[model samples]
Target: MSILANPLYRPLFEILRSARNGIVYGGKLRFSHALVINLLYKSGPLLPRMKSVFEATKDHAQVLASFAIIYKIAVHFLQSDAVLGRKNLRLTKFLAGCFGSWIVYSGHFNLFNGGITHQITLYCFSRVLLALGKILLDKYLVCFQPSFINYQGDTMLYKNLNGHQQRKLKNLIYNKSWKYFAIITWGLVMFVYDYKPQYLQSSLRHSMTYIYDVEMDTWDTWREFLGI
Candidate 1:
């Protein structure tokens, strides 16, 4: 009955595993690594705690936390590009807003949990910020790459387009917008879910700590064995 062994966990695990594979076996390994690390910190551990806020019947916060981390990582491949498409000023402003909000939320959560030593809900806030930063970095890297966005060796704007070109432009706009909306919506859902008392538990209140302990040891072993 372990959450990690459950069928539902497979999808999340596969995504992370695939990311690891891409990092190891595919090109752009640094991109994959940056992406995975960003995801692990933000969505992995904090997801289940957010879920525990609403559903009292399910007793698997730790598992959810693990999912959150995995989910954060998987979605980044989809979301970061959207933020990068915007103007630099707008992107910077949006990220600044998110950072300020995170600081307030983190401070409040830490204080509510009793003190800095308690560190409640900080991971959730920290993940949100990390996600935003990753998007910025990804976009910056893309900008330098040139091949993805350059058209006839031009980076400037064009005022006119024919039917075929317009259709392609439309698709690009829609695709970016759809992804941006999805990421924002998902992030908002997590924020709302994390605020409820039902999800909030005293530290060490989870049903399974052994799984995390095992996973931690496994992670360390892999890190050492792989020299990663």
Candidate 2:
């Protein structure tokens, strides 16, 4: 117990534990998603159906687990020797993440065509990019920070706004901003899909093509729906 609990071994313990958690979490999440999407998009022999699900599950779980292990190792390595003489917490975390991500992106964990790994990485990148943007907004564009987040500051003009006006501005920046962003995004994506669908990811392009470009003038679709 003492040896396992020793600080010297803490990093190893953390890496193992994180890897286990990542495998369980990533497998479950991808299994549910792949099952539902396959049911909607494809139907065939039981072997292929099970194979696709199992392969996707393995790829997602492996990527997550490997990333967890790599990140822990990288972070600990950085924290070990302050080779730079001065350390930044944000730098340590960001660099460690980048290290782990690069190893994964270099085709280490994924063994298939890698579309799933690419999508997963892109999803995480977009989310981290958004959160980083919000952090910057809070730091510099402090007034645009979400209403729900509280902080201290009393810049001169900030003191002049009444509660109602403050709430309104916060709503514009925090809440309605996303609503409009989505509206604009859908409009833009549809426009792009019409003219430059090749620029879209294959998954998105195929889905959009099926949804938007399929012949609606046909009674065939209606017949299928009606089981005719």
Candidate 3:
């Protein structure tokens, strides 16, 4: 029977589908990205610039498509039979992410001296960090309040804590976590951009400089004011 027809391998179809979609989507996105960057910074004949963009699209798209296929396969293959058909285990996901990334992204794309690969991986790293944070919030949450015990070794937390206080604290966290996270994220990026800009991607560093380092001189013209 086909892998899709078997219950044990129903996700094979999704893996294949992901691969196909990755090629198409990554190609389009990489092509646009390369083309835009070339238009902005490259000084060359149109034909040569288009040729360069095409070459970049090929390498970047290949890297993205390969990672998509490999990660999907790794996630499925690493699943244990005892917990099959459930959300992927964190340990399995960690192993699969590391191993698959090692296999598929071991080499860099040939765009801008492989800067495209750096950009992709850095973006993925940020996204994966946020995703894992969300997962931890959902599955591994803990109360920082110290547990009190009676003469016997039993947690008095439940007895001391009422449901309203529990709900209030949970509500406070749920409502305000994102606010603090956003502020801290911005602060960290600015800190890096200020003193350790070499740690940032070239495009990001350049963009930050444009935004933050440009002189606030008197406006010379209406065109300048209007950003024409």
| Backbone collisions counted per model | 11, 0, 0
For model 1, give the 10-residue run with minimal summed lDDT.
54-63
Question: Which runs of model 2 end up more than 4 angstroms from their true locations?
Answer: 82-86, 106-113, 141-156, 159-169, 220-223, 226-228
The TM-score of candidate 2 is 0.79
Question: Which residue pairs clash within candidate 2?
Answer: none
lDDT (tens digit, per residue) of candidate 2 on 64-147: 898899998888878766542226667888888889877876576454347766788678776776566556655654554333
lDDT of each: 0.45, 0.75, 0.73
**Overall local distance difference test of candidate 2:** 0.75
**How many clashing pairs does model 1 include?**
11
Best-performing candidate as measured by lDDT: 2
**Candidate 2 vs candidate 3, TM-score winner:** 2
lDDT of 3 by residue, 23-63 (tens): 78878998998899789766879999999999888877777
> Order of candidates by TM-score, top first?
2, 3, 1
Better-scoring candidate (TM-score), 1 or 3: 3
TM-score of candidate 3 to 2 decimals: 0.62
